[model samples]
Target: MILCCGEALIDMIPAPVQTGGTGYVPHSGGAVFNTAVALGRLDVPTGFLTGLSKDLFGEQLRETLGNSRVDTRFCILSDRPTTLAFVRLTDGHATYTFYDENTAGRSLFPDQLPDLPDEIGALYFGGISLISEPCADFYAALAMRDADERLIVMDPNIRAGFIRDEDRYRARLDAMIRRTGILKVSDEDLEWILPGPGPLDEKAGAIAARGPKIVIVTRGREGAFASFSDGTMVTAPARRVEVVDTVGAGDTFNAGVLAALASDGLLTRAGLEEIDGPRMKSALEHGARVAAVTVSRAGANPPWSHELSGPDPD
Candidate 1:
């Protein structure tokens, strides 16, 4: 099972109401939450590890997990309020304004972390949860601690506005990247991580040199580029789709790559270290296909197993 560790919250998105005014509608979302649900919907054995509130929004998030077939036994429940991110869209792109002070998912302490069982072969981490305090440290520590035993996959999904301390966050990310087997980042994320004067692939390569066996740099509509630690590079083109909104596109893309790797039995620690160009390219293509379906719809809703063409990755 792949255990996704990070924030899970409600997204209050804008909608057109009858009076020609914008109305906010609540949707269950968060980067890690989206990936976990996407994995579950794709029929991968998945589990979620995060702090959840007893609030109504938390209940909605939990129900979404259950419906997607994700295991929630690892969730830490509390009376703290749930985090809410209000989203704005412009021509299919998305922006978020978050209200996340002392929320359940942001307040997780290291002591509250659950010990994982043998079934969890991989651990995925990312999003604003990595920017929040107490919980960010908690997750960073968890990822480093479990690195030796399981495959560690991370997509920082960096949101610059949420980071309070640039130095501290960069340090934390550097440490995590050293232990990460697969590292996925956006073009903007790559630029921020290694700012100034370098080609995208070179910058990605620099990151790969730090530690990750595989470094995937997603280029929005252009698609994704990957660099393996063993000197192999591959690229996958984005699928052409009439995008409705890009809410969960990257999150679902991460799930698709993982699912494809899992299907090819390359999700294991050793398998990742020995990954070649073709296999990695195949995984990226699969991710593009999955993400295409996500962008073609509304919200963070990823396609169900039956929705994709060909044999199920599960």
Candidate 2:
């Protein structure tokens, strides 16, 4: 089972066609939430660990999770309201403006964490959780406390505006990277985290030294590249598609990679470190294929397992 921990919230997106031609529409969103839903759709045994509100929005979010077949036993319900994010898409890219200062998901404390199952093959962490307060520390502690035999995946999904302390954020990110076995980052994320990069190899090398066995750098529509601790490097071209939006492409890609790894029985800690050329390539290809499907869709909705099967299997 894969346990995805982080925020779960509603995203206000632009309507397909504005009446007056100026406003946004609402959709269910959040990084880990998207990943969990995608995994569930792929028929992967997935669970979500996060705080939800007793309010209507939270109830709706819970229903959404249930519809996706994601186990929500670890979800905590509180008096706090569910978080909200306003997403704006332009030129096929999506940006978010969040309103989660004191939302339920951000209220997660270390003491509230559920006892993890011994059969958990992987744990995924990302998004605003790493930038928030008590929750941030809580997630970091969970990553540190988990046995090294479990696969740990992280995607920072950095938002510069929300971050108050740069040094503290960098320190936390660096520390989290050290604990993660799989690190998926975007070109924007790299530029934001590590400025001025003449050679991406140097940046990838620096990330590898931080303890991640595999570091994936996504280059939007261009493609993605991966570097393994064993000195294996592979690259794949992004599948061409008429993109509706890129809202949850990265999160969907994360789901695809984890799903592929889980299906192959390689989502364990030892499995991560033992990944070789063929395994890494297959994982990356799965990620790319899933992401392509997401881009071809409207919202953050990823394809189901059957939808992902192509005429010619790679």
Candidate 3:
């Protein structure tokens, strides 16, 4: 099982009303949550670990996860309210105003973390969960705890605006990256992490030096690029599809990559270290294909195994 650790929240997206003005609609989202759901839909044995509220929005999130077949037994339930992010989409791009203070996901502590079962072969960490306080530290601790055993994957999905303290967030991220076996970042995320005038690979290499064995950078329509610790590099072009909204595209892409890795029996730490050019390229293509289906639809809705072409990941 690939156990994803992070936030599960409600995205209040703008919807058109018959009365002329726009109204927001609740959508089950959050980067880590989206990826977990996508993986489950792709027929991967997936589990999600996060702090969940008993609120109505939390119920929606739980239902969504259940429908997608993502195990939620590891979730820590609380009476705290669910975090809400009001989204504004400009030409299919999304920006968020998060109401996250004191929310269930943000209030999680290190002590609340559960012992993992041997079935969990991989552990994924990221999203706004890495930006907040005590919970952020808790996730960082979890990653470090299992760093030597399970395959650790992370996609910082950096949301700079959500970061209250840059210094602390950077330190936490740096520590997590050092333990991350596979690290996926967007073009914007790469820039923010390094922030300089240089070639993409050069910046990605700097990040690779920190510890991640494999580094993947997703460039929206241009596709994705990956560099391995052994100096092997591969690229995949984005799949063409009519635009809906970019929300959850990157998250779904991460799911595809993980699913492909698992399908090829490369999801283990040793397998990732031994992965080659052809296999790496195949994974990238698979990721792009899966993400295409997501962007072609609205919200963070991902395609089921039957909805995608070729064989299922299982």
Highest-scoring model, lDDT: 1
Task: Return the TM-score for candidate 1, rounded to 2 decimals.
Answer: 0.97
Residue pairs in collision within model 3: none
Instruction: Identify the runs in model 3 with alpha carbons over 4 angstroms from their true place.
Output: 310-314
lDDT of each: 0.93, 0.85, 0.92
Candidate 3 local lDDT, 1-314, one digit each (tens):
89999999999999999999999999999999999999999999999999999999999999999999999999999999999999999999989999999999999888777899998989999999999988998899899899898999999999998888999999999999999999999989999999979988888888888999889999888889998877779999999889899899999999999998999777777777767878888889989988988998898999898888666443
Model 1 Cα shift for residue 229 (angstroms)? 1.2
In the range 1-314, model 1's lDDT, one tens digit per residue, is 99999999999999999999999999999999999999999999999999999999999999999999999999999999999999999988999999999999999987776788998999999999988999999999899889999999999999998999999999999999999999999999999999999899999999999999899999988999899877779999999888999999999999999998989777778777657888889899999999999998999999997899676443
Instruction: Show where candidate 2 strays beyond 4 Å.
Output: 16-19
Shift of residue 241 alpha carbon in model 1, Å? 0.9
In Å, residue 45's CA in model 2 sits off its true spot by 0.8
Candidate 2: count of backbone clashes, pairs at least 3 residues apart or interchain? 1
Supply candidate 3's per-residue lDDT for 163. Answer: 87
Q: Distance (Å) between predicted and true CA of 170, model 2? A: 1.1
